[model samples]
Target chain A: MLESYIEQLQRVETLGELNDQVVALRDTLDVEHVVYHSVNSTGEQYAALTYSPEWVQRYLDEDYTRIDPVVQACYRRFHPIDWKRLDWTNKNVRNFHGEAIDSGIGNQGFSVPIRGPSGQFALFTVSGNASDDKWASYTQEHVRDLLLVSHFVNQKALELERGTDQVQTVSLSPRETDALTMLAMSYNRAQAADSLSISEHTLRVYIESARFKLTAMNTTHAVARALSQGLLII
Target chain B: MLRYIYADDLHRFPRLARSMFVDRAKQFHDRLRWDVTLRDDGTERDDYDDANPLYVIWEDTTGGHGGSMRFLPTTGDTMVNDHFLHLTDGVEIKSPFIWECTRFCLAPGAPAQVSAALMLGGMELGLNNHLSHSVGVFDARMVRIYARLGWGPTILGTAGQGRDATSVGLWAFEPELRPRLLSRAGITDEMSRHWYDRSFGALTPTAKPALSA
Candidate 1:
């Protein structure tokens, strides 16, 4: 079911369409609410959530982000967090939680943080009213699926923000890829040359040319770049 | 091969450990340009290394560091709790089932599989110790690498931007994923198991007791 949603997400071209898909996802997953909120590096904020407009406006007017433990905790963490694990001990936080509950935001929440290129930060969250044990089990069973969704949503968001549909790719020749792959596998020049049925000098030429194509400083840098760019699988 | 060496045990592999630290200095301080302290000995050492953290290192054929990562239980003072709390919105992650992995470094000419091997070693540590997750703070470039390895972490939050963007992520331990990681590292199951058992076999419940009755 989530896989289908990820497929739909990939085709969504506009933020409005993404919001509709998120709403549909909330219903499909039987969650009370789903929220995708992003704050780009330049501090531009966008949100597609199930919360009421009045509540959303109130949150911004009152600057609840300053007090919301979920936002605060999620902002700092690199792992999915259960609302129960967050610190709500402070008076301000307690009041914020109470207000959120009163606004039909539910008593339980789980959030996944997303970090995209250019310092884009986003949170994909699900909240609902449930028993502690029920919520725990729910999150446990669905964490992986939700994580995949969070990242995909963020990727789409970044793509839309950048207004570019084409993914940038660098093409390396077959021999170049083999040379870098060999180097990445920790094969020395002689060994790589032997395995590739080429002379050591020829292998060096391939590596140096590959390095130039990758704009790398050396063999190590070229291998690192190739791997990071998903150019060489190994 | 993966060698799990604690700080106290580092003396047993003096040259390998020294090379590991030197490579760390080169990667973090020189190449990445992270704000790290480099010692007069041309090595990078930090407060966490003094905490007796376990180091998972891949040794090359020459018996030097190929790639390495540092692990310390989150229950103790760790890099995330002590220095990176702001990234976590001030919440300190302290769990017996979760450890903090940091300072992942590779030698200048190390092969790419070294990274995957180091990750495999991390998974082995989690499985052997019954840990559920490992957390780390990494940069944008590492995100791509992790994704490529099919072991991307669930990011908790991020700071900075562009080339400097840093994020904290938690990696869950799924025993079923071991085979895929093994293949990625180009390591056979037998060798992986041997390395793991060599490091932790005695601690297992099935292992024979040192002082037999």
Candidate 2:
């Protein structure tokens, strides 16, 4: 099933195609739901999933992001994290969960956190109804494949973003290329810090410095420019 | 030992945030379908980080921030109280003594003792702040983790799905439970099974209220 998901990922060459393919993958997965979401280097994002429009809108309108433990925790790490490992011990977060379940998004989920040059990030998650034993076994079975697909999709999406871009820019330093590539590769600050053998503070300085040179507002935007402007390769 | 770093002090420590996949962290992007990057100027600022206490646990020798947690004292501006309006419902919340714990994280690949250190740090920070009782909504699965650390169910709490779709419960790690915990340190899991099989639990130590100016 995941092999076919990868096949679909490979066939898609455009962001629109990827979006449609993502939805198709969800339908194919035939579990309950599948979602591919991204915060691109431009900070413009795309979310293609099977979540009810009501839940999606309510979540956005209510700004549940700040209170969401899964989103909050995933942002802080580099690995593809399960929704279960997150801390959900707050009252509002619980309310958010109740609302999500009511929307038919299910309780069991696996999220693949992805990164692209210029701070591009995307999380592809599949949520469904299953026993703990079953879900654990399922995730264990497919974790590696999903991780690869996540990065592949994000890379393609970045390339897609580049194809549609109207902007242009100069070359990036090797360190800058490495930095954006790490961010592109979904290296969270700590892992990215270690990968670079630099302090996270210094990494931020490097990132912000890159942002300044690129005339970008933030790291995501910086990454977007790097990709769209051909400053960094995926 | 625990070294607390404010988000601002993310400058001094350097390792935690920098080592993090910069764009992937909460400030840049969230893993869910939704992206919550700051719109005002593309900065990430939750309510608690500014007004409530935000702490990052650091290794004193290496200065690596191994874990972090956010604390919101029971107050009007706090999200644990204000934002979570639906859950509180008609329940009574005795003000000024409770704290809402949020975003507790362990630095990836830290030593096993790190969580224990974080607990000690949290208690000390709470005691010094004049807070007495503490409340945390927990994922039902990790009830064992909290139970092992020192918290216990004070209430069943509101019926709700957890952040992860797991069952959840409300718990309290009150100061009054300290002696019973320490005196029973060597107790077997059988004896400790007052409610569940969790091995770790915090015995709330003596309450030391902060002196008023």
Q: Which parts of model 1 have CA positions greater than 4 angstroms off?
A: A164-234, B1-213
Of the true interface contacts, each candidate retains a share of 0.00, 0.00
Worst 10 residues of 2 chain A by lDDT: A73-82
Q: Candidate 2 lDDT, tens digit per residue, B94-211?
A: 2233455655555556565555555555554444333444555434445555567664443323444443422212333444554444333333333333211111122122112223
Model 1 achieves a DockQ score of 0.03
lDDT of 1 by residue, B104-194 (tens): 8889988889989999999988875556678787775798798788687766568887656778777878899899899999999989989
Weakest lDDT window of 10 consecutive positions for candidate 1 chain A = A208-217
- DockQ for all candidate structures vs. native: 0.03, 0.03
Best by TM-score: 1
Worst 10 residues of 1 chain B by lDDT: B203-212
Give per-residue CA lDDT, model 2, range A74-186, as digits (tens).
55233355666665557677677777777788777777655343345677788887777777778776664555455556656665777745333444556657778899878
Q: Taking the tens digit of each residue's C-alpha lDDT, what string does model 1 give over A1-234?
A: 654565577678888998898888787677999999988879998888999888899899999889887776556234456666566767777676777777888878888766444345788899998877778789877775676566667767777788856664556767778878998999999999889886554466456546544545457867987898899986
